[model samples]
Target: MPVIDITSDPEALTMTVVAEFDAPVERLWSVYTDPRQLERFWGPPGWPATFALFQLSVGGRALYAMNGPRGEVARGAWEFLAIEEPNRFEVLDTFVNEDGSAIDGMPTMRMTFGFEEAGAGSRMRCVSHFTSAEALEQVIAMGSIEGTRLAMGQLDRVLHDLREYSQGQGTQTEVLSDTQVRITRLVDGPRDLVWRAHTEPELMKKWLLGPDGWTMTECEMPDAAPGPYRYAWAPVDGGEGEPFGFDGEVTLMDAPRRMVSTEHMTGTEYPPTLNDLQLYEEDGATLITMIIMYPDAATRDMVLATGMTDGMEASYARLERELLAV
Candidate 1:
């Protein structure tokens, strides 16, 4: 998980929060630019936010309200001062009443959000500058620090689900048949990036590792044609357990579209599984479908019992970060 660090100082008249995410900068920017996504995590625990108006352009306006307990509502408005894609933006925020009117003498803020590339992931830093020390203290006393932290905590999970959805990867598992199981996900980006990430040895080394302290030392896929493909992995520290590896033959191949392969995890007695992959493209996005077929019901159940899906989910999350960065 990424770390969320927040700090505020009345003497400085500012509140700043910083965090890193295992996602692309562009996807992270969507949380601020897209009102629907913004509403999902913009408020604290029980106080859900609702946006009535949102415009992502210079001099544009955003009107939103948060519903609190006992039928109370707090409204706010933001006037965009600057707009930059996947990078930074600035806005002037005003505390307002429920009827879209500003409260007289209420504290206002100038907020700036920054996004940058951090290795394979992205970092976000937000600063809220108040007009005076008294105003800053007032907001802090109103629970802004704790509320903002809670809201950001929810943002992490929201990004995970959104990343999977954008990639056309479904979060739910489907038992297609007694001997088969299917996993599907939607991926944002071009077909070439998706294809390369899925096939190329170096790119696969980046995202295909199941968990921490594990690395794929060797990956060989000389040709997409029906032949040999091998991948070997081991603990980074040369720990005690047995090394894990897989090698298989490509039964069929079609660039940027479909492929069929047979794969088996070594150091185990399980039979080799047949995997069929299909890719669909629509409006700059790709949906990847992977179907795994086992020889018998027992083998399929055994594989599922090993908690492979959890590892797959984490691997796919890493793939999303890689794809977006590309």
Candidate 2:
């Protein structure tokens, strides 16, 4: 978690957030300035940002949209107010419509971002100035604080080299919240191939099997969004475990980059989980990030206790060995 503290002051009509990073001031500033890097962490997990226009100069405007897992979008714009190289910048942030026009009755705030060198790294202090206490309260009630914190928590992956940060990590799982779990794996393959391995039935059957002695018996891949997809596996040679499968609908798909789906166990009435999968390729390899939102904490715990992470690791290792290496 990069965010150190967040404070709100009604009298001052401002909300401030302070965060520390293990990178220098210049490095930290570059991530904010570069649209590609900014997109990686501009939004919280499961809601990624896409920048349509980024003009980094005083009086210029940047337009972007945060895309939700369920195909929802929230558009926003930033009008640059000040820029001081690697030290600070200011912008007027506003909620906007699809056409880039300000949304009616939505409050806009002036934000100042300051970067300074800390002991071995850097620190960022951001202050959002509101027109009135009511406006500040409104934003807080809308989850701005927690959203900002979660967004900043993703910065470490952006600041560090992908391979250095994730290679050999296998399939790692992090409990993001009571109902949310994030899983990541670095595969030694290109993004397109990895994406194909997930979406194509032929390719998926080659590596998606959790462990040896199991075979993918059924693989029904959906061709488009809102379509049904299912996968089933069975033990080979009369092995001990019973056959099992999962069925889901692909809710959103951005070819080779992102896909969102709702997953549920076949033949069961368990509540479905939302799965947001994203792929990022760097240095000839791809990083797979999947965030799963469970129905409740109990369900989350139940799923984790089933050795899901270990199964995923085995599958990913097989992906590299059987599919990618070949």
Candidate 3:
């Protein structure tokens, strides 16, 4: 999807997505409207969704169900707003009842899809508009920032796959892809310094999650291998400020060389991310390569969009400060 000029007030409930497609208007429209086509390339990067049934007519309703990393299903529905083939279309998407009925007291979103000829291919935009800013605020309130980004990120793979398939036939033309977020860092410190910066609760509090109200409550570094280590951080937001937490199983633990941990966010029941941290000597400084693999494409994307690597950058910044202190 291409980026569009949006006039949403973040303080309210806002849902907007802009994407560009390299295919022609007809192909893009077909993929958007057809349930099978959608199922084929449905979802963003890490989170993939399956559309159960679809009918592209006024007052016609459709069902969509998305499966998450831990056997959880997220289902929703949409009613056709306007259906114009190969050009424009709109729909009202809603979270519904068990019998496939719309749920009361829930905000139904209006989504619009537009495909225009952009040079050799097309510029496609999908926008989901909400009724109020409160809806948007509620999502943030519920700590849904990461989940939302993951969902959108999953779309990247869908578009990429769609583009590659069409271009191979010499039929599809201008699919646009966004730049991926990459991380690069130079830690000018000793191996022990870096390890302590990561493992020790005292030092970790400075560079890791923090300790004022947010404290590293528990940490277990690998004793022999990676089997039994867990690092837990909790925010004392309400009572003691323990607002958030991430727990993981140590998959690999080789000091100053590589470390791997499978992490699940505190609020979530299932582990959704695998954290791989590699440390090596480059020139005179220590080089670290960190990779986070999600359970599915959708979850990975959500974390990316929520500035996951940005947190890495911040951690590095703090590491630099701690090094200077020593």
Quick one: RMSD of model 1? 16.8
TM-score of each: 0.50, 0.99, 0.46
Q: Summarize candidate 2's per-residue lDDT along 1-326 as a digit string, tens digits.
A: 99999999999999999999999999999999999999999999988999999999999999999999987898999999999999999999999999999999899999999999999999999999999988999999988898998899999999999999989989999999899899999999999999999999999999999978899999998888879999999999899899999998998878999989999999999999999999999999999999999999999999999999999999999999989997
Q: Write the per-residue lDDT of candidate 3 for residues 169-277, one digit (tens) a residue.
A: 3111121123222233556666667866766566776777532345566666555444655566666555464355666667656676656676777667654565556
Q: Each candidate's lDDT (Cα)?
A: 0.78, 0.95, 0.58
Q: For this target, which candidate reaches the highest TM-score against the unseen true structure?
A: 2
What is the lDDT ranking, best to worst?
2, 1, 3
User: Candidate 2 — number of clashing residue pairs?
Assistant: 0
lDDT, model 2: 0.95
lDDT of 1 at 64: 97
The TM-score of predicted model 2 comes to 0.99
> Model 1 off-target regions past 4 Å?
1-3, 162-326
Error of 3 at 93 (Å): 0.7
- What lDDT score goes with residue 61 in model 2? 96
